[model samples]
Target: MSNIPFTLHTQNSAAINVSLLYAASSKYEGEWSGTPHSHPYAEFFYVLRGEIDFQAEGEPYSLHEDDLIVINPDVNHTERPRGPGTVEYVSFGVEGLCMDPADSGMWSSCSLFHCRQSRSEVRFFLRLLLAEFENNLPNYEQLCCHAFESLLVFLKRAHPQELAVTAPKRTARECSAVKRYIDANFRQPISLDHLAEVSQLNKYYLAHAFREYIGLSPINYLNSRRVEEARVLLRDTSHSISEIAGIVGFSSQSYFAQVFQKAVGESPGEYRKRLRRGRQEKQE
Candidate 1:
């Protein structure tokens, strides 16, 4: 029998600053043996095939094909193979991005997330990422990174249960309309009145329909979108917090800070610092 315990392939060839790692194994049928471990960087695992049993903080679960698992930084966890089939997965270790567990809006408390992608579009992307990992083509790292981002976006939209919201059914067009409005006006001082006007529905009906269709109230959705935009700007640019606050439509930096803290569990400045440190550590 081959003695290779586990294979971890690390890639640093991306034009961007993020690090990508791919790991796969088949010898997981024995007693659980992975040491309880954690990473300072966020880890996203996409299960390509087979089953793997996972335990996070004493809660146990099993994952199958097309399932995405997120183990945030510093979370204690362990995993082992579940059956005789091969267990293949790709793990992304991002450096410059800081993900707030709270911002996910699915879990009230911090915990590991196991998300299944039933949508064909999402499953297609997952398969494409897996193929790239297995083949290691030229420029595959960049392709994999883009596919990974798309996968996350898909998961965020489709996996409401994971985000602690009831799943709702609405055509993609309707959902897009709501999301587009929020994205376009989140930085401005927007209100339900403005949103209902934009969506062309009465205030009460719009509020109810939006909640039933999109899974969040208008105000809550706007806040989340603005915070997400601010996070990206804080990480990617040298803009000051006050400048970003204005650009994202918050009238005051203090208000922005308060909302950000409540949603992200950290102030904008602190979040930016954490992302910078994460990148620097990866470089070293």
Candidate 2:
């Protein structure tokens, strides 16, 4: 699956940020609904009335009243009204959430919930959330945070599916092995499939676990290592830019320049020139 290369491996998730963004009760139009969109934050759709077809992770699901659907970060999805029917959905998005280790594993693993049972309890929490946002009473921020956390607690307790499947952590030995492999062989054409095979992991598990620990896709991490190697070549060796690009596994000089600038905030030639100029000034 295609995904953005944004990740953070944080030990203290309590420092992670979370917010209740844009809680509104409205009827969406029946025409074309909205274009497929993805965000870096998590979002949920709670349908109080009416039915709509929702798509997540490229799969279509029919949602009805009391259904809670979560769309995970960076997952592309869209909604379409069912046969000119309007959907009354109360939705909110959150970012940088923290949970217990097991909960975090479950949270990272699952996104869509076909239905969260207990309509009245879920409805009550939804109303409470909307009220908290609207009232803005004193200490409302703490109140809202508690209310949101309670709502998730209710969902998790009510639905075992959320806890059913979790990603297994790669042993430190295996993680170190993968890191060493990347460091030693970033110049080779290393694909996710190849890494998955070497690490004895499925593609999805490998991608998720690797990012959970390393904070980057294996390919991006490999690119970073390649860029660091290229920097050394540019500084200490007499290789041409094209030759350096080849040595670094970059297909073309232009692509190498682009990745180098993105990683180091400067072009290869500019970086080399600045370093040489600094050395000369030191000699003077």
Candidate 3:
């Protein structure tokens, strides 16, 4: 046998960095349609079971199991179950990456990688990533992030030219706007969907980013704001608990009392009475 020497050299610089915004699994049954919305970062969907009818920019495509779709940024799309059966899929919001499916004339702004022929790796990575989230063990964030990067690497290997790395822009301005809106409208009915529409962000991503920056989820922050106002009313004004609850935008006094008790140490009435007792003792 002849001896042969082979050495491979590669650059040490880093490439293909992606930030996982959010990853989730969903199962839909019967007739359900999502509102058409667009985001600033690329979104991905992998059909695990059943069929999904996806509409992007008014173009409809029937996606079956093992079908992978990568939607570029700012492309309005919606999905629903194709038929009577249930449609289950895993979705990911990825920042710092974009897809250019120029070779496929049929898919204009998005690329569809048909994984029917070879789907084992895709299935494995997604299943493992979701399990990490479901289990939420120690250092699950790091594990999930690595799993996400592995899945992205697989996509890049499958279609080298279609995927490219781009850093995700910071969303400080948008997050600030959401905070301002919540501060102004805390006395009115608010929901996550409304917040998503206001910020033009996917709700999941918005919630994640808001929590990271503000230390609380959007709805939680809103409730905190309401509770803050309720405390002021409880201390300064002699309004009834029910009246104060209505003034702070709570639908029912019981819910307001429950939330107030959770945030503070005691119920609203108890808090007010304690304050009154302290004030009377000071006067005496």
Clashes of each: 4, 0, 0
Error of 2 at 277 (Å): 76
Count of backbone collisions within predicted model 3: 0
| Candidate 3 per-residue lDDT over residues 166-253, each given as its tens digit | 4332654466568768877999989999999999999999998887545689999899999999999999998999999999988899
Q: State which candidate has the highest TM-score.
A: 2
Q: Which stretches of candidate 3 lie over 4 Å from their true place?
A: 1-17, 102-108, 167-284
Better of 2 and 3 by TM-score: 2
* lDDT, residue 216, model 3: 82
How accurate locally is residue 234 in candidate 1, as Cα lDDT from 0 to 100?
98
**Ranking 1 against 3 by TM-score, winner:** 3
Per-residue lDDT of candidate 1, residues 1-284 (tens digit): 11111212212222233444553333333345567675554456666667788764345768777666666444456777785656766555543232323234321112344455354676677667667777788877667777766765665566434432111122222433555667666777888888777777787876766665446777778888889889999999999999999999887999999999999999999999999999999999
**TM-score of each predicted structure versus truth:** 0.41, 0.50, 0.49
Q: Write the per-residue lDDT of candidate 2 for residues 4-68, one digit (tens) a residue.
A: 12233233332333555556677765656468776665677888778878875445788877777
- Over 4 Å off in model 2, which ranges? 1-17, 98-110, 114-116, 164-284
- Model 2 residue 8 CA deviation in Å: 18
